[model samples]
Target: MLTGADGRYHWPLPPATYTLTAHCPEDGSGGGTGEVTGVVVTDGRESTADITVE
Candidate 1:
């Protein structure tokens, strides 16, 4: 999934562990790849994960 113009993304997933990844290509702009492992999503709650590309 891609993020909006506000640089934010969301996904509705079942309660479980997950890995989130983000990638930016070298299109003359900033380019990098970031990932977050072991993300925990729970029932009746919102989970937030942040990946910093370098």
Candidate 2:
């Protein structure tokens, strides 16, 4: 999924622990990748994970 202009993305998944990763392609300038591991999501609750790519 792609993030909006604010660099925010939304994805719904079944309640469980997961590891998420995000990557930005290098277009000559620069690019990087980030990952968030051991994320927990519960029913009727919201989980937030902030990843910063270098």
Best by TM-score: 2
lDDT of 1: 0.90
What 10-residue stretch in candidate 1 is worst by lDDT?
Answer: 21-30
Residue lDDT tens for model 1, 1-54:
889998898889999999988898788876899999999999989999988887
Error of 1 at 38 (Å): 1.7
RMSD of 2: 1.1
Model 2: per-residue lDDT, tens digit, 1-54? 989999998898899999989998898868889999999999889899998876
Model 2 poorest ten-residue lDDT run: 23-32
Given candidate 2, what's the lDDT at residue 2?
Answer: 89
Cα lDDT of all candidates, in order? 0.90, 0.91
TM-score for predicted model 1 compared with the true structure: 0.83
